[model samples]
Target: MTAKAHADAILNLLRTAPGTPLTVLDGSVPNGTVAPYVLVYFADEDPELPDSRPLDGQSQRYVVRAYVHSVAGNGAMARAVGDRVRSALLDAVPTVAGRVCWPIRREEGRPPERDESTGTVVMDRVDVYRLESVPA
Candidate 1:
Protein backbone atom coordinates (compact mmCIF):
# COMPACT_ATOMS: atom_id res chain seq x y z
CA MET A 1 0.00 0.00 0.00
CA THR A 2 1.01 3.60 -0.42
CA ALA A 3 2.29 5.67 2.49
CA LYS A 4 -0.93 7.69 2.61
CA ALA A 5 -2.94 4.48 2.88
CA HIS A 6 -0.71 3.27 5.67
CA ALA A 7 -1.19 6.52 7.58
CA ASP A 8 -4.92 6.44 7.04
CA ALA A 9 -5.05 2.91 8.38
CA ILE A 10 -3.16 3.91 11.48
CA LEU A 11 -5.36 6.93 12.06
CA ASN A 12 -8.49 4.83 11.70
CA LEU A 13 -7.19 2.22 14.07
CA LEU A 14 -6.42 4.74 16.75
CA ARG A 15 -9.67 6.63 16.28
CA THR A 16 -11.72 3.46 16.79
CA ALA A 17 -9.65 2.00 19.63
CA PRO A 18 -11.37 1.96 22.96
CA GLY A 19 -9.83 4.19 25.68
CA THR A 20 -7.65 5.88 23.13
CA PRO A 21 -7.62 9.66 23.24
CA LEU A 22 -9.19 11.68 20.46
CA THR A 23 -7.05 11.13 17.37
CA VAL A 24 -6.22 13.71 14.74
CA LEU A 25 -6.69 12.48 11.18
CA ASP A 26 -3.95 14.78 9.99
CA GLY A 27 -0.66 15.43 11.72
CA SER A 28 -1.41 19.06 12.44
CA VAL A 29 -3.29 19.81 15.63
CA PRO A 30 -5.82 22.60 15.34
CA ASN A 31 -5.15 25.91 17.10
CA GLY A 32 -7.63 25.21 19.87
CA THR A 33 -7.30 21.46 20.05
CA VAL A 34 -7.62 20.04 23.50
CA ALA A 35 -4.86 18.08 25.13
CA PRO A 36 -4.74 14.31 25.53
CA TYR A 37 -5.07 13.97 21.80
CA VAL A 38 -3.24 11.73 19.35
CA LEU A 39 -1.60 12.66 16.06
CA VAL A 40 -0.97 10.06 13.37
CA TYR A 41 1.01 10.75 10.23
CA PHE A 42 3.12 9.14 7.56
CA ALA A 43 6.81 9.66 8.26
CA ASP A 44 9.02 7.95 5.71
CA GLU A 45 9.48 4.78 3.70
CA ASP A 46 12.30 2.33 4.29
CA PRO A 47 14.96 2.25 1.61
CA GLU A 48 15.47 -1.12 -0.03
CA LEU A 49 18.62 -2.89 0.99
CA PRO A 50 21.25 -3.83 -1.58
CA ASP A 51 20.07 -7.43 -1.61
CA SER A 52 16.41 -6.57 -1.90
CA ARG A 53 14.46 -7.52 -5.01
CA PRO A 54 12.07 -5.49 -7.11
CA LEU A 55 9.15 -7.65 -6.05
CA ASP A 56 9.93 -7.27 -2.37
CA GLY A 57 7.13 -5.80 -0.34
CA GLN A 58 7.10 -2.13 0.63
CA SER A 59 7.84 -0.83 4.09
CA GLN A 60 6.46 2.49 5.31
CA ARG A 61 7.05 4.38 8.52
CA TYR A 62 4.32 6.12 10.49
CA VAL A 63 4.56 8.30 13.59
CA VAL A 64 2.10 8.53 16.45
CA ARG A 65 2.34 11.38 18.91
CA ALA A 66 0.39 11.69 22.12
CA TYR A 67 0.00 15.08 23.70
CA VAL A 68 -1.37 16.22 27.02
CA HIS A 69 -1.58 19.52 28.83
CA SER A 70 -0.51 19.42 32.44
CA VAL A 71 -0.28 22.21 34.94
CA ALA A 72 2.13 20.22 37.08
CA GLY A 73 4.64 20.15 34.24
CA ASN A 74 4.87 16.40 34.66
CA GLY A 75 4.50 14.11 31.69
CA ALA A 76 2.43 11.46 33.45
CA MET A 77 -0.70 12.15 31.47
CA ALA A 78 1.22 12.19 28.23
CA ARG A 79 2.86 8.93 29.10
CA ALA A 80 -0.48 7.38 29.87
CA VAL A 81 -1.81 8.38 26.48
CA GLY A 82 1.31 7.03 24.87
CA ASP A 83 0.82 3.74 26.64
CA ARG A 84 -2.70 3.54 25.31
CA VAL A 85 -1.43 4.14 21.81
CA ARG A 86 1.21 1.45 22.16
CA SER A 87 -1.28 -1.03 23.51
CA ALA A 88 -3.50 -0.45 20.53
CA LEU A 89 -0.85 -0.40 17.83
CA LEU A 90 2.26 -2.34 18.73
CA ASP A 91 2.44 -5.52 16.69
CA ALA A 92 -1.12 -4.91 15.57
CA VAL A 93 -2.23 -5.46 12.02
CA PRO A 94 -3.97 -2.51 10.38
CA THR A 95 -6.21 -2.90 7.35
CA VAL A 96 -4.85 -0.97 4.42
CA ALA A 97 -6.89 -0.46 1.29
CA GLY A 98 -5.89 -2.74 -1.60
CA ARG A 99 -3.08 -4.27 0.43
CA VAL A 100 -2.29 -7.00 2.88
CA CYS A 101 -0.33 -5.55 5.80
CA TRP A 102 1.85 -7.38 8.23
CA PRO A 103 1.79 -6.67 11.93
CA ILE A 104 3.15 -3.20 12.72
CA ARG A 105 6.54 -2.95 14.40
CA ARG A 106 7.79 -0.07 16.52
CA GLU A 107 10.91 1.46 15.01
CA GLU A 108 11.63 4.02 17.71
CA GLY A 109 10.16 5.81 20.71
CA ARG A 110 10.71 9.13 22.43
CA PRO A 111 9.81 9.64 26.02
CA PRO A 112 7.44 12.43 26.91
CA GLU A 113 8.90 15.90 26.65
CA ARG A 114 7.62 19.36 27.34
CA ASP A 115 6.73 21.55 24.41
CA GLU A 116 6.84 25.29 25.00
CA SER A 117 6.39 26.56 21.50
CA THR A 118 2.65 26.69 21.94
CA GLY A 119 2.92 28.88 25.05
CA THR A 120 1.20 26.21 27.11
CA VAL A 121 2.46 23.48 29.37
CA VAL A 122 2.18 20.51 27.04
CA MET A 123 3.90 17.15 27.07
CA ASP A 124 4.22 14.85 24.10
CA ARG A 125 5.54 11.40 23.36
CA VAL A 126 6.47 10.20 19.94
CA ASP A 127 6.46 6.65 18.64
CA VAL A 128 7.53 5.53 15.21
CA TYR A 129 6.37 2.34 13.54
CA ARG A 130 7.02 0.46 10.36
CA LEU A 131 4.39 -1.37 8.34
CA GLU A 132 5.14 -3.85 5.61
CA SER A 133 2.65 -4.54 2.88
CA VAL A 134 2.03 -6.15 -0.48
CA PRO A 135 -0.68 -5.45 -2.99
CA ALA A 136 -3.67 -7.68 -2.56
Candidate 2:
Protein backbone atom coordinates (compact mmCIF):
# COMPACT_ATOMS: atom_id res chain seq x y z
CA MET A 1 0.00 0.00 0.00
CA THR A 2 1.32 3.42 -0.86
CA ALA A 3 1.07 6.60 1.21
CA LYS A 4 -1.45 8.15 -1.14
CA ALA A 5 -3.61 5.06 -0.92
CA HIS A 6 -3.56 5.20 2.84
CA ALA A 7 -4.64 8.85 2.75
CA ASP A 8 -7.46 8.06 0.41
CA ALA A 9 -8.74 5.34 2.70
CA ILE A 10 -8.74 7.67 5.66
CA LEU A 11 -10.61 10.33 3.70
CA ASN A 12 -13.18 7.80 2.63
CA LEU A 13 -13.72 6.69 6.19
CA LEU A 14 -14.25 10.25 7.36
CA ARG A 15 -16.61 11.06 4.54
CA THR A 16 -18.86 8.14 5.44
CA ALA A 17 -18.49 8.07 9.20
CA PRO A 18 -21.73 8.90 10.91
CA GLY A 19 -20.11 11.01 13.57
CA THR A 20 -18.23 13.26 11.22
CA PRO A 21 -19.58 16.59 10.07
CA LEU A 22 -21.72 16.84 6.96
CA THR A 23 -19.14 18.43 4.61
CA VAL A 24 -15.91 16.50 4.17
CA LEU A 25 -13.41 17.58 1.53
CA ASP A 26 -10.37 15.83 0.17
CA GLY A 27 -7.65 18.49 0.15
CA SER A 28 -9.41 21.23 -1.78
CA VAL A 29 -12.36 23.30 -0.64
CA PRO A 30 -14.72 24.48 -3.33
CA ASN A 31 -15.56 28.17 -3.58
CA GLY A 32 -18.53 29.30 -1.49
CA THR A 33 -18.49 26.12 0.55
CA VAL A 34 -20.71 26.47 3.56
CA ALA A 35 -19.17 26.68 6.98
CA PRO A 36 -19.02 23.75 9.44
CA TYR A 37 -17.04 21.45 7.21
CA VAL A 38 -13.94 19.26 7.32
CA LEU A 39 -10.83 19.42 5.15
CA VAL A 40 -8.62 16.33 5.02
CA TYR A 41 -5.22 16.02 3.35
CA PHE A 42 -1.95 14.20 3.54
CA ALA A 43 0.83 15.70 5.58
CA ASP A 44 3.98 13.52 5.87
CA GLU A 45 4.89 9.90 5.36
CA ASP A 46 7.81 7.51 5.71
CA PRO A 47 8.56 3.84 5.32
CA GLU A 48 7.45 1.82 8.30
CA LEU A 49 10.76 0.00 8.49
CA PRO A 50 13.48 1.49 6.38
CA ASP A 51 15.81 -1.47 6.90
CA SER A 52 13.29 -4.06 5.81
CA ARG A 53 14.23 -5.56 2.47
CA PRO A 54 10.67 -6.17 1.32
CA LEU A 55 9.46 -2.72 2.44
CA ASP A 56 6.75 -3.48 4.94
CA GLY A 57 4.53 -0.52 4.14
CA GLN A 58 4.17 3.12 5.12
CA SER A 59 3.50 5.27 8.14
CA GLN A 60 1.44 8.18 6.89
CA ARG A 61 0.45 11.40 8.54
CA TYR A 62 -2.71 13.28 7.68
CA VAL A 63 -4.16 16.61 8.68
CA VAL A 64 -7.85 17.02 9.43
CA ARG A 65 -9.25 20.44 10.00
CA ALA A 66 -12.76 21.35 11.13
CA TYR A 67 -13.90 24.80 10.12
CA VAL A 68 -16.89 26.88 11.06
CA HIS A 69 -17.98 30.45 10.50
CA SER A 70 -18.28 31.98 13.92
CA VAL A 71 -19.47 35.52 13.91
CA ALA A 72 -19.09 35.55 17.66
CA GLY A 73 -15.39 34.85 17.19
CA ASN A 74 -15.80 31.76 19.33
CA GLY A 75 -14.66 28.27 18.43
CA ALA A 76 -17.47 26.27 19.99
CA MET A 77 -18.78 24.93 16.70
CA ALA A 78 -15.36 24.18 15.36
CA ARG A 79 -14.42 22.40 18.54
CA ALA A 80 -17.55 20.31 18.38
CA VAL A 81 -16.78 19.24 14.86
CA GLY A 82 -13.22 18.45 15.85
CA ASP A 83 -14.44 16.29 18.68
CA ARG A 84 -16.71 14.36 16.34
CA VAL A 85 -13.89 13.87 13.89
CA ARG A 86 -11.59 12.57 16.59
CA SER A 87 -14.19 10.15 17.83
CA ALA A 88 -14.96 8.95 14.35
CA LEU A 89 -11.35 8.30 13.36
CA LEU A 90 -9.41 7.49 16.50
CA ASP A 91 -8.51 3.81 16.78
CA ALA A 92 -10.57 3.08 13.71
CA VAL A 93 -9.15 0.78 11.07
CA PRO A 94 -10.12 1.63 7.51
CA THR A 95 -10.21 -0.71 4.57
CA VAL A 96 -7.66 -0.04 1.84
CA ALA A 97 -7.03 -2.13 -1.23
CA GLY A 98 -3.85 -4.26 -0.96
CA ARG A 99 -3.26 -2.95 2.53
CA VAL A 100 -4.13 -3.74 6.10
CA CYS A 101 -4.40 -0.47 7.93
CA TRP A 102 -3.94 -0.34 11.67
CA PRO A 103 -6.02 1.70 14.01
CA ILE A 104 -5.66 5.44 13.34
CA ARG A 105 -3.81 7.27 16.07
CA ARG A 106 -3.81 10.95 16.78
CA GLU A 107 -0.35 12.54 16.76
CA GLU A 108 -1.26 16.03 17.83
CA GLY A 109 -3.99 18.64 17.89
CA ARG A 110 -4.22 22.42 17.89
CA PRO A 111 -6.79 24.66 19.49
CA PRO A 112 -9.26 26.38 17.26
CA GLU A 113 -8.14 29.66 15.75
CA ARG A 114 -9.80 32.35 13.74
CA ASP A 115 -8.78 32.66 10.10
CA GLU A 116 -8.12 36.30 9.30
CA SER A 117 -7.09 35.70 5.69
CA THR A 118 -10.51 36.36 4.21
CA GLY A 119 -11.68 39.00 6.67
CA THR A 120 -14.19 36.46 7.91
CA VAL A 121 -14.34 35.05 11.38
CA VAL A 122 -13.72 31.46 10.44
CA MET A 123 -12.72 29.20 13.29
CA ASP A 124 -10.70 26.12 12.49
CA ARG A 125 -9.37 23.34 14.67
CA VAL A 126 -6.49 21.29 13.34
CA ASP A 127 -5.47 17.74 14.20
CA VAL A 128 -2.85 15.35 12.88
CA TYR A 129 -3.12 11.57 12.76
CA ARG A 130 -0.79 8.70 11.98
CA LEU A 131 -1.83 5.56 10.11
CA GLU A 132 0.42 2.57 9.71
CA SER A 133 -0.28 -0.01 7.08
CA VAL A 134 1.18 -3.23 5.75
CA PRO A 135 0.61 -5.18 2.58
CA ALA A 136 -2.36 -7.50 2.79
Candidate 3:
Protein backbone atom coordinates (compact mmCIF):
# COMPACT_ATOMS: atom_id res chain seq x y z
CA MET A 1 0.00 0.00 0.00
CA THR A 2 1.05 3.58 -0.56
CA ALA A 3 2.09 5.76 2.37
CA LYS A 4 -1.08 7.86 2.15
CA ALA A 5 -3.22 4.74 2.25
CA HIS A 6 -1.34 3.40 5.22
CA ALA A 7 -1.82 6.66 7.12
CA ASP A 8 -5.50 6.67 6.19
CA ALA A 9 -5.98 3.17 7.55
CA ILE A 10 -4.43 4.15 10.87
CA LEU A 11 -6.58 7.25 11.02
CA ASN A 12 -9.68 5.21 10.30
CA LEU A 13 -8.92 2.82 13.12
CA LEU A 14 -8.25 5.66 15.58
CA ARG A 15 -11.42 7.50 14.55
CA THR A 16 -13.51 4.39 14.87
CA ALA A 17 -12.37 3.55 18.38
CA PRO A 18 -12.23 7.16 19.62
CA GLY A 19 -10.28 6.36 22.79
CA THR A 20 -8.71 2.89 23.01
CA PRO A 21 -5.44 0.95 22.82
CA LEU A 22 -4.88 -1.16 19.76
CA THR A 23 -2.15 -3.54 18.63
CA VAL A 24 -0.93 -4.57 15.21
CA LEU A 25 -0.36 -8.29 15.35
CA ASP A 26 1.51 -8.62 12.05
CA GLY A 27 2.05 -7.32 8.55
CA SER A 28 3.55 -8.56 5.26
CA VAL A 29 3.67 -8.63 1.47
CA PRO A 30 1.45 -11.21 -0.15
CA ASN A 31 2.94 -13.49 -2.81
CA GLY A 32 0.81 -13.59 -5.93
CA THR A 33 0.04 -12.26 -9.42
CA VAL A 34 -3.28 -10.73 -8.68
CA ALA A 35 -4.39 -7.34 -7.38
CA PRO A 36 -4.25 -9.46 -4.30
CA TYR A 37 -3.16 -6.30 -2.54
CA VAL A 38 -4.89 -6.34 0.83
CA LEU A 39 -4.75 -3.74 3.58
CA VAL A 40 -4.93 -5.41 6.94
CA TYR A 41 -6.56 -2.68 8.97
CA PHE A 42 -7.15 -3.38 12.63
CA ALA A 43 -8.01 -1.60 15.89
CA ASP A 44 -7.89 -2.64 19.54
CA GLU A 45 -9.43 -0.86 22.53
CA ASP A 46 -7.50 -0.77 25.81
CA PRO A 47 -10.00 -1.52 28.56
CA GLU A 48 -7.43 -1.12 31.35
CA LEU A 49 -7.69 1.83 33.63
CA PRO A 50 -5.55 3.39 36.38
CA ASP A 51 -8.29 2.82 38.93
CA SER A 52 -11.54 0.96 39.33
CA ARG A 53 -13.75 3.87 40.22
CA PRO A 54 -17.34 4.16 39.05
CA LEU A 55 -16.63 7.63 37.66
CA ASP A 56 -13.81 6.26 35.53
CA GLY A 57 -15.14 5.81 32.06
CA GLN A 58 -11.63 5.21 30.69
CA SER A 59 -9.92 6.23 27.44
CA GLN A 60 -8.77 3.97 24.63
CA ARG A 61 -6.19 3.91 21.85
CA TYR A 62 -7.05 2.64 18.38
CA VAL A 63 -4.49 0.77 16.28
CA VAL A 64 -4.06 -0.42 12.71
CA ARG A 65 -1.75 -2.58 10.51
CA ALA A 66 -1.15 -2.26 6.79
CA TYR A 67 0.45 -4.76 4.43
CA VAL A 68 1.84 -4.50 0.93
CA HIS A 69 2.82 -7.31 -1.41
CA SER A 70 5.37 -7.73 -4.15
CA VAL A 71 5.43 -10.66 -6.59
CA ALA A 72 8.64 -11.98 -5.14
CA GLY A 73 8.18 -14.19 -2.15
CA ASN A 74 11.22 -12.66 -0.38
CA GLY A 75 14.25 -10.89 -1.78
CA ALA A 76 16.68 -8.03 -1.24
CA MET A 77 14.55 -5.46 -3.00
CA ALA A 78 11.53 -6.67 -1.09
CA ARG A 79 13.47 -6.30 2.11
CA ALA A 80 14.30 -2.73 1.20
CA VAL A 81 10.65 -2.03 0.47
CA GLY A 82 9.69 -3.49 3.80
CA ASP A 83 12.37 -1.47 5.52
CA ARG A 84 11.06 1.74 4.04
CA VAL A 85 7.58 0.81 5.08
CA ARG A 86 8.59 0.27 8.70
CA SER A 87 10.58 3.50 8.73
CA ALA A 88 7.58 5.38 7.43
CA LEU A 89 5.44 4.03 10.24
CA LEU A 90 8.03 4.92 12.85
CA ASP A 91 8.47 8.45 11.54
CA ALA A 92 4.73 8.97 11.42
CA VAL A 93 4.19 8.30 15.14
CA PRO A 94 6.14 11.21 16.59
CA THR A 95 3.95 13.62 14.73
CA VAL A 96 1.19 12.90 17.23
CA ALA A 97 3.22 13.24 20.38
CA GLY A 98 2.40 15.59 23.34
CA ARG A 99 -1.00 16.52 21.95
CA VAL A 100 -3.36 14.23 23.82
CA CYS A 101 -1.76 13.45 27.19
CA TRP A 102 1.56 13.92 28.93
CA PRO A 103 4.02 11.12 29.53
CA ILE A 104 2.80 8.68 26.87
CA ARG A 105 4.50 5.97 24.86
CA ARG A 106 5.26 6.44 21.19
CA GLU A 107 3.05 4.44 18.86
CA GLU A 108 5.00 1.43 17.57
CA GLY A 109 5.29 -0.04 14.09
CA ARG A 110 8.04 -2.56 13.46
CA PRO A 111 9.17 -4.72 10.56
CA PRO A 112 10.03 -8.12 12.00
CA GLU A 113 10.84 -11.01 9.72
CA ARG A 114 12.86 -14.16 10.02
CA ASP A 115 14.01 -17.19 8.09
CA GLU A 116 14.52 -20.37 10.06
CA SER A 117 16.68 -21.72 7.30
CA THR A 118 19.41 -19.22 8.06
CA GLY A 119 18.36 -18.22 11.56
CA THR A 120 18.12 -14.68 10.33
CA VAL A 121 15.58 -12.14 11.43
CA VAL A 122 15.25 -8.64 10.12
CA MET A 123 13.49 -5.81 11.92
CA ASP A 124 13.69 -2.70 9.82
CA ARG A 125 12.03 -0.04 11.92
CA VAL A 126 10.10 0.16 15.16
CA ASP A 127 7.87 2.91 16.55
CA VAL A 128 6.06 2.59 19.86
CA TYR A 129 2.95 4.61 20.61
CA ARG A 130 2.68 7.51 23.03
CA LEU A 131 -0.66 8.66 24.42
CA GLU A 132 -3.10 6.62 22.36
CA SER A 133 -2.98 9.03 19.48
CA VAL A 134 -2.69 9.39 15.73
CA PRO A 135 0.14 11.42 14.18
CA ALA A 136 -1.71 14.63 13.54
Candidate 4:
Protein backbone atom coordinates (compact mmCIF):
# COMPACT_ATOMS: atom_id res chain seq x y z
CA MET A 1 0.00 0.00 0.00
CA THR A 2 1.10 3.59 -0.59
CA ALA A 3 0.88 4.43 3.08
CA LYS A 4 3.01 1.48 4.05
CA ALA A 5 5.54 2.42 1.42
CA HIS A 6 5.72 5.92 2.76
CA ALA A 7 6.08 4.67 6.29
CA ASP A 8 8.82 2.32 5.26
CA ALA A 9 10.70 5.15 3.64
CA ILE A 10 10.34 7.27 6.72
CA LEU A 11 11.55 4.41 8.88
CA ASN A 12 14.51 3.76 6.62
CA LEU A 13 15.54 7.36 6.96
CA LEU A 14 15.74 7.03 10.70
CA ARG A 15 18.53 4.51 10.26
CA THR A 16 20.84 7.40 9.50
CA ALA A 17 20.84 8.57 13.08
CA PRO A 18 24.37 9.47 14.16
CA GLY A 19 26.61 6.87 15.78
CA THR A 20 24.21 4.09 14.93
CA PRO A 21 26.10 0.87 14.31
CA LEU A 22 23.36 -1.27 12.87
CA THR A 23 22.20 -2.00 9.36
CA VAL A 24 18.93 -0.48 8.22
CA LEU A 25 16.56 -2.81 6.47
CA ASP A 26 13.50 -1.85 4.48
CA GLY A 27 10.49 -3.95 3.46
CA SER A 28 11.54 -6.47 6.07
CA VAL A 29 8.84 -6.22 8.71
CA PRO A 30 6.73 -9.36 8.74
CA ASN A 31 3.43 -9.07 6.94
CA GLY A 32 1.59 -12.10 8.30
CA THR A 33 2.24 -11.29 11.94
CA VAL A 34 -0.45 -10.28 14.40
CA ALA A 35 -0.94 -9.99 18.16
CA PRO A 36 -2.86 -8.44 21.06
CA TYR A 37 -3.00 -4.68 21.58
CA VAL A 38 -4.10 -2.83 24.70
CA LEU A 39 -4.64 0.73 25.75
CA VAL A 40 -2.50 2.36 28.41
CA TYR A 41 -5.39 4.09 30.04
CA PHE A 42 -5.17 7.46 31.77
CA ALA A 43 -7.69 9.62 33.61
CA ASP A 44 -8.58 13.23 32.94
CA GLU A 45 -5.65 13.64 30.55
CA ASP A 46 -7.19 15.72 27.81
CA PRO A 47 -4.91 18.71 27.31
CA GLU A 48 -7.73 21.07 26.40
CA LEU A 49 -9.90 19.93 29.29
CA PRO A 50 -7.48 19.03 32.04
CA ASP A 51 -10.09 19.55 34.69
CA SER A 52 -12.68 17.38 33.01
CA ARG A 53 -12.79 13.69 33.63
CA PRO A 54 -13.85 11.35 30.91
CA LEU A 55 -17.40 10.18 31.40
CA ASP A 56 -15.91 6.76 31.99
CA GLY A 57 -13.19 8.38 34.07
CA GLN A 58 -10.50 6.64 32.05
CA SER A 59 -8.41 7.97 29.19
CA GLN A 60 -6.82 5.77 26.56
CA ARG A 61 -3.22 5.95 25.53
CA TYR A 62 -1.69 3.96 22.67
CA VAL A 63 -4.69 2.12 21.30
CA VAL A 64 -2.53 0.36 18.72
CA ARG A 65 -0.71 -2.93 18.44
CA ALA A 66 2.90 -3.63 17.61
CA TYR A 67 3.58 -6.86 15.76
CA VAL A 68 7.15 -7.12 14.56
CA HIS A 69 8.66 -10.41 13.42
CA SER A 70 11.83 -11.15 11.50
CA VAL A 71 13.87 -14.03 10.13
CA ALA A 72 17.12 -12.11 10.33
CA GLY A 73 19.73 -12.68 13.02
CA ASN A 74 19.28 -11.16 16.46
CA GLY A 75 21.99 -8.54 16.31
CA ALA A 76 22.85 -6.30 13.37
CA MET A 77 20.22 -6.35 10.67
CA ALA A 78 17.34 -7.38 12.84
CA ARG A 79 18.13 -5.08 15.73
CA ALA A 80 18.73 -2.10 13.50
CA VAL A 81 15.53 -2.76 11.66
CA GLY A 82 13.63 -2.98 14.88
CA ASP A 83 15.18 0.16 16.27
CA ARG A 84 14.50 2.19 13.16
CA VAL A 85 11.02 0.82 12.75
CA ARG A 86 10.15 1.62 16.33
CA SER A 87 11.64 5.07 16.16
CA ALA A 88 10.06 5.79 12.79
CA LEU A 89 6.66 4.58 13.89
CA LEU A 90 6.78 6.73 16.99
CA ASP A 91 8.01 9.71 15.03
CA ALA A 92 5.62 9.37 12.11
CA VAL A 93 2.69 8.54 14.35
CA PRO A 94 3.47 10.26 17.60
CA THR A 95 0.07 9.33 18.95
CA VAL A 96 0.97 5.64 18.77
CA ALA A 97 2.83 6.00 22.04
CA GLY A 98 1.45 5.57 25.54
CA ARG A 99 -0.19 8.97 25.46
CA VAL A 100 -2.71 9.18 22.59
CA CYS A 101 -6.01 7.44 21.82
CA TRP A 102 -5.28 6.16 18.35
CA PRO A 103 -7.99 4.07 16.67
CA ILE A 104 -7.59 0.36 16.17
CA ARG A 105 -8.37 -1.66 13.03
CA ARG A 106 -8.27 -5.33 12.20
CA GLU A 107 -8.70 -7.66 9.28
CA GLU A 108 -10.20 -10.54 11.25
CA GLY A 109 -10.63 -9.38 14.84
CA ARG A 110 -12.75 -7.01 16.90
CA PRO A 111 -11.41 -3.47 17.15
CA PRO A 112 -11.59 -1.03 20.05
CA GLU A 113 -14.68 1.13 20.41
CA ARG A 114 -15.53 4.29 22.34
CA ASP A 115 -17.99 4.22 25.19
CA GLU A 116 -20.85 6.52 24.26
CA SER A 117 -21.77 7.55 27.79
CA THR A 118 -18.21 8.05 29.03
CA GLY A 119 -16.85 9.48 25.78
CA THR A 120 -13.92 7.20 26.37
CA VAL A 121 -12.31 5.60 23.38
CA VAL A 122 -14.34 2.83 21.81
CA MET A 123 -12.06 2.09 18.84
CA ASP A 124 -8.76 3.23 17.43
CA ARG A 125 -7.28 2.95 13.95
CA VAL A 126 -3.54 3.18 13.32
CA ASP A 127 -2.63 3.38 9.66
CA VAL A 128 0.96 2.73 8.50
CA TYR A 129 2.33 2.26 5.01
CA ARG A 130 5.73 0.77 4.18
CA LEU A 131 7.27 2.81 1.38
CA GLU A 132 10.42 0.88 0.60
CA SER A 133 12.02 -2.54 0.91
CA VAL A 134 15.64 -1.99 -0.02
CA PRO A 135 17.78 -3.58 2.63
CA ALA A 136 20.70 -1.60 3.99
Q: Highest lDDT: which candidate?
A: 2
lDDT of 1 by residue, 1-136 (tens): 3767777777776777776345554657677776777766565545565554355455432333222221124488777777777777778888877777778777778877788887878887777766777556
Q: Give the alpha-carbon lDDT of every model.
A: 0.64, 0.66, 0.35, 0.31
lDDT digits (tens) for residues 11-35 of candidate 4: 3444443454334334342443222
| Model 1's TM-score against the true structure | 0.76
What does the lDDT come to for candidate 1?
Answer: 0.64
Ranking by TM-score: 1, 2, 3, 4
Where is model 1 poorest over a 10-residue stretch in terms of lDDT? 63-72
Which pairs, if any, clash in model 1? none
What is the overall TM-score of model 2 with all chains considered together?
0.76
Q: 1-136, model 2: which lDDT tens digit per residue?
A: 3656777777776777684345778777798776788887675534445453353344442323222221224599888777777777789888878766678888788888888777767787888777766557
